[model samples]
Target chain A: MNRLNGTLLRTSLRRRSFSTADNVDGNLQGSKVQIFDRHLKRKQRDRAAWLINRKDSLVNTVADNLLDRLEDVKKTFPTTLCLGGSLEAIRRSVRGRGAIQKLIMMDSSYDMVKLCKDAEKDLASDNIETSFMVGDEEYLPIQASSVDLVISCLGLHWTNDLPGAMIQSRLALKPDGLFLAAIFGGETLKELRIACTIAHMEREGGVSPRISPLAQVRDAGNLLTRAGFTLPGVDVDEYQVRYNSALELIEHLRAMGETNALVNRIKFLKKDTALATAAVYESMFAAEDGTIPATFQVIYMTGWREHESQQKAKRRGSATVSFQDIQKEFGAGETT
Target chain B: MVRANRVVEISKTLSEILVCPLSKQPLRVCEKSNSLISDAIGVSFPIVDGIPCLVPKDGKIIEAEVSRDGDSANTKRRYHQDGTGGS
Candidate 1:
């Protein structure tokens, strides 16, 4: 479990059904409703492999922003693992420096892995090797205490067992190893969520959960700490993208492989329900200029595998100055 | 990779850190079969186009190979989950 005190957390861990065991479909009578369908997600990503390889604008932005975290660290990570996004982008972000000696790229989707492998074939040689593998985040393929760094970008939200995935990642790290990741936070796509809810409630007489649930930013640090990580740091970033209309926004989600992957989701919305949703989206949430605003919240998390050499917080009651004295020294009502 | 001219194989660095997701045992690269095999787990994972498909669902049982090796007196069965060699 990721504990609350670490910095650097890797996201984008896919929980694929690689068990070789199959449960009967439409069998939600007794079992809990699965939020995301791992099989469908793999197919969806495979379908979007071309778009991902070509660098969709939003994907590029998030991947670039996430990789920027590496610039602050001074130590070299001899073994580095990355999941999601393009390999070319990863190579560019870590370019020219000695931070990574052997870079391993992994993804649950075979097509996506192939897309990345095809793009960065030149990086492999006798000295620096790049290995690509089809791996599920829920079941990591690395040995314990093996890798120095692990980075995940824009993919963890799909995992059914998010905590388990994080735990496996922690196990894959050596002491003092770093984990950096970016995941969709709770506030992401709020406009879409609201629009869909209102639209369905109006048309179908009740609302169904259409949007995928995201992890809350507040819980990220705690989760990391509980996962056996120390010195955790978490931050949230929001981006607003404007579409010409709500319909365009939905289309954008479809093309970018961001459509709902919920297993218990309604297979299709009635034609009028969709139209009503679009109308509701435009009327209730759109800007005065008639543009639809989609809010995207990303929670960036970081943590370090606990090690003896790492710094620790000082004990309590160690302050040099008392609260009243500090207040008086700065500025208070009765300093005398 | 250098796979253009030579046989496609898992690199030394990668094999060092990789393990069976099910049994958590170190994988031995079998270049002849283009797969990563773990005799201890009696499972082998295929490597296609230089990418290792290590998913458990895709794993293949290799008990026959392990039994053949057991016939020889040189190696001991040290990888069994129960810590005893299987009969």
Candidate 2:
């Protein structure tokens, strides 16, 4: 919990169901930033290290997928964007010399921004030059047509403005630029959301459910098209994990620095009903493996910015300029 | 374990002074778990090392060990007769 001892309190933390973008109170911004800055403290670091271990297992399975597509990414754009790039873990996986020219790690959470900046220490010398920006996915601070590849891992689902974020993502890319992202899809926490809902309704008249709903990749592809990305591709995979108990699951989230910052938070528990609600939760969701099951859906998407040449050809009404000729000309060291 | 000890020491100093951010209610250090419990929130904030994560997701709502049938009689009397509901 964030506490302010002697700071101006003109605003409060706004709770929203989707994003923390507009919810930050102007007055509390400093304190909130301060809290995030303290993320590297001994306790917080320990928690983060623990959580990364859990998340790494799933990340490893799809490590090949991220690497294989780098050639395609390189062909399209020189600069790559990793949205909510947690500790720059994805960077370590891409094992080539100067595979990407520039890396932009974007996250609204200050702690994550700090983490990415500090991660410079862990970067390889031959790795692409990296930079950090703090902003929500929906509203990036970078200029339009500035980026070549946009990649997000397990972070887009938390965006309050998912559609807007996607649109902004497409707008930021140059025509022919690629967009790739992964997130927990709808089936992700289905069991948990259901169990929590049932338990809350049974025990208390009602309880707040905070599980984020993720979009399936097909739906994501549609979003990409709507956002003006060309030849969009979508694929899905699930990672099933077992945790020791509800507490352990929670600890893992905390360690990963994932917590609810949604604006629409419920204030008070129903009259004398919280304890029973927790009991119901434990009984229903606790597993025989002594670990609660968490399923993550990783969505991979690739799309190009509509090539300007295609538009030019369409207007000219003649197929004079060939792609091969353009490739031959631009392929000889194209400047991104 | 050393981290846990540091937390304990901090909790002892913070127990009476700390108040809930949301409700502004007085907080007490839970003996069993060494967590901070706010009567208003009905949740225990786990104390880790020297830090207390009062985030709702990190909190565990207290469950009365007493069954519903057993609780109806005593809790009704306790909640109605006394302002403090044995929290």
Question: What TM-score, over all chains together, does every model reach?
Answer: 0.77, 0.57
Score residue A144 of candidate 2 by CA lDDT.
Answer: 63
Model 1 residue runs over 4 Å out of place are A1-34, A53-55, A85-88, A121-128, A314-336, B1-7, B62-87
Q: What is the Cα-based TM-score of model 1? A: 0.77
Native-referenced DockQ of model 2: 0.01
lDDT: worst 10-residue window of model 2 chain B:
B9-18
Candidate 1 CAPRI classification by DockQ? medium
Query: Per-residue lDDT of A21-140 in model 2, one digit per residue for the tens?
Result: 765642211223221222222234344544566245666555556556766533734577777634355666655622577776655454545555566687667546665544445445
Q: TM-score of chain B, per candidate?
A: 0.63, 0.59
| Candidate 2, lDDT over the whole model | 0.57
Candidate 1 per-residue lDDT over residues A43-74, each given as its tens digit: 77777676543445666777778778877888
Worst 10 residues of 1 chain A by lDDT: A1-10
Give RMSD to native, each candidate.
8.2, 19.6
lDDT of 2 at A208: 64
